[model samples]
Target chain A: MKSESRKEEIIRAASILFKEKGYSAVTMRDLAKAMGIKAASLYNHIDSKQEILSTIIIELAEEFTTGMNQIVNSKVDAIKKLENIIDLHIDVTLRNSDGLASLNNDWMHLEEKNLQYFEKMRQEYEENFRAIVKNGVDREEIKPFNIEIMVFSTLSTLRTLYLWYPKQKNIDAEILKHDMISVLLKGMV
Target chain B: MKSESRKEEIIRAASILFKEKGYSAVTMRDLAKAMGIKAASLYNHIDSKQEILSTIIIELAEEFTTGMNQIVNSKVDAIKKLENIIDLHIDVTLRNSDGLASLNNDWMHLEEKNLQYFEKMRQEYEENFRAIVKNGVDREEIKPFNIEIMVFSTLSTLRTLYLWYPKQKNIDAEILKHDMISVLLKGMV
Candidate 1:
């Protein structure tokens, strides 16, 4: 394989192990073993286990950051913006469900600098999400419920879609997205 | 402390460690250290680390089981039943947010018999939740979205409330429940 594809393959293998055993429990040798390569050869593509983890997590985080930036900059109404945001989550999460377990559960185990960066990105993401909800409430487009609860309920459901979406193989993406919006934004009642 | 209170305290400390390190990473010695007790004394109240984990997880699962049974049997409409189900989640999750981590992330680590039992409880819970959603759709009380998607969306949000609820300390329980019902059952749009 080409060098770039080789690195991608290594990261893919690492994500599977990370998802199963978590970051701390997993080791470079174990990852190499899972990939059917010598440990020394593994080091040729990745600097260290930390580097592999940082790649898996930071790349995925940056994707969200980039997506959220686009959504925030759009001139759409809050409800429209929120729907686009949900679409972004479904798209990104479905594509990278493997890395999501680490994104959700193992980011804290990142080395100090990476940990800080992840935390900052997460904080900013929430602030931007809250802004959308606040705008919706202000425009009376959304109900005047507690903003925190609104954000929490909506975001939490979207955040964990990776866990549920994969099991639902037969459901079309459009159908799933429509149903999610209905249940989450339009309320089931 | 009395024996019963001591057991509770042990479970409490175990939950904190379990939440931070996960069930597989946490040890009996670590639980004792967190509780400021000896490891030998730890065994006096709990049979093993597995038992501590089982107690934390199985008890919570059983509570949901019992709560779902109550809601399923109620004479109320499907929407009311769902609201009651949501209330049960928020109440139980808030009270045991720490244990909720174990319940969500660590149940897979449970030993054979306990693991089987936990899985059984979870399967039944989902079936009953689906039944409620199906009833709603059939009665024309709920929109005819895909039943699995609706249940997945609703339960995923409620299931992960433990991750978000503790952080929002200022939100009152009644307000949380009301907003949740409005956003979930009524949709924000």
Candidate 2:
């Protein structure tokens, strides 16, 4: 395989391993074995297990940052912005469920520099999310509620969508998105 | 401390370490250091690190199981049953935020017997939760959307409430519970 795809393949294998055994428990040799490659050959592509974890988590975090940045800058109302945000989560999660798992579960194991960077991006993403919810409450587009509760309720459910995605694989994405929005945004009653 | 309170203190200290370093990463020595006690002394109250984890998680899981059983057997309507379910989660999470963290994040690290036990309880809890939702749909109490999505959204948010509870400590528990029930059970719109 070409170098680029070879690197992608290694990262993919590492994401799955990291998801299963977590970042700390999964070793470089284990990642290599999962990839059906020798440890020496694994080093030719990725520098260390830290690099694999950083790649999996930081990349996915940056994707969320990018998506949140878009949602924050959009010329849309609060509810519409949230719908767009849900779509962003669904799209990103469905495409990168394993990587998202690492991002959620193993992010605490990120090395020092990457940990700081991840913290900054995570705080900013949450701030952008809170800002949108605050706007919604101000404009009366959404129900008046505790902004933190609203944001937490929304983001926690959205962030952990990966945990449930594998089980719901057969369900169409669009239908899942609609059901989520309706239940989360609209309520069952 | 008395033996019972000492055990509670040990569990509390272990929970903080486990929350920060995860179950697999946390050692008995680390847990004892956090508690300002000797590792040998720590074993007097807890049998092992695994026992501490099992105490933290299995207790919380059983609390949830007991609460879920009550909800399942209640004579209330689906929405009321869900509200009770939400209250149960809020009450348990508020009281045992750290233990809840271990339950949500570290239960997978449980030893064989505990792992199987946790899985069994978790599956039964989800099944009972689903039965309530299914009954709601059949009785036309809840909106007929996807059952799994509705359950996932509700439970995921409920499960991760501990992650947000500490940050919102200034918020009153009653108000927090009210807002959560409103947003989650009644929908934001």
Candidate 3:
């Protein structure tokens, strides 16, 4: 792993702190103290706690948006696209579960323009997901279930992976990816 | 609907307030103001805000425990038991989604024995779910995908139904139940 910049270190520490205590509850002093640095030194690298939150959240949101965009535009079928999407989530989760936790819980605390940008990315992600499911139905690539139900069930499972995956120590990444893709796409029975 | 007892009235009003503004932020005055009753009147029915929160959450947790116990004890096969569990969540979501919001978002605020009780019920609920899935695999009634994966995927979707079900107006209960069971049990493709 490459040495992280001071800003990256601050963001990383803040993400974990935010996950534990929530965005509003975490102050910069708490963050600096966690890092064994003085509080004033933090302002040199980042402006405010909001900046840390937005950086942690927006960066992850954009990562998802980018992943979903590529998957949606790919020539693969809906099921394949979905597999890739699941892999994207697992990949992100494995690398930075703490950051994902902050993104999930602290995105709402984003201010003004950054908030709008994050929301837009999220909505587009969902819309792209919906369109893929609808396309699957139209082409008979998938079953004729309620489109919204299918979308909601699958997305909800994927979205909550950050909370579930960490507790699972016996299950490795490859097994998780393979089993998750199957259970999600092919069902349990 | 049957008439609500005065205590029930306070619990219902406080649940909505808790959902709107999280349990920590909402005050007894806020709940009383929302209910259009005097603060002293609220005290007459409910002992404290903690009482209101515990009543909403512990009651819902007990309801799930009861429903799961019946499902687990039934003579049905594992797949049938899983379907029954899905129906239980839908029934509860339909009945008191606001109370569920508190249970999901603020159950940690439940002090003392109530917190312990809620966690125990939640763990048992998950254990029973795991047992049913394992039984299904043994009986060849279900695929042997990672038991934890299957359980997590299904339960996460069901646990989050309260948040999603309220926004979906066009989909009636029948369709939601049918489609959810199908998508969760049989997969989307």
Please state every model's RMSD to the true fold in angstroms.
Answer: 1.9, 2.3, 1.8
Instruction: Please provide, for model 2 over A1-189, each residue's C-alpha lDDT reduced to its tens digit, 9 standing for 90 to 100.
Output: 688789999899888888887787888889878877789998788788888888888988898899889888889898988999899999998898999988887888888999999999999999998889888888999888898899889888998888888877567998998989999999877
Please tell me what DockQ candidate 3 reaches.
0.91
Which interface RMSD values do the candidates have, in the order shown? Answer: 0.9, 0.8, 0.6
Candidate DockQ values, in order, are 0.82, 0.82, 0.91
Worst 10 residues of 2 chain A by lDDT: A162-171
Best by lDDT: 3
Order by DockQ, highest first? 3, 1, 2
Q: Give the per-residue lDDT digits (tens) of candidate 1, residues A65-155.
A: 9999999999899999899888988888778898988898789889999999999999999999999999889999988999998898888
**lDDT minimum window of 10 residues, candidate 1 chain A:** A180-189
CA shift of A106, model 2, Å: 2.9
Q: Candidate 1 clashing pairs?
A: A185-B187, A185-B188, A186-B187, A187-B186, A187-B187
Clash totals for all models, in order? 5, 0, 0
Off by more than 4 A, model 2: none
Candidate topping DockQ: 3
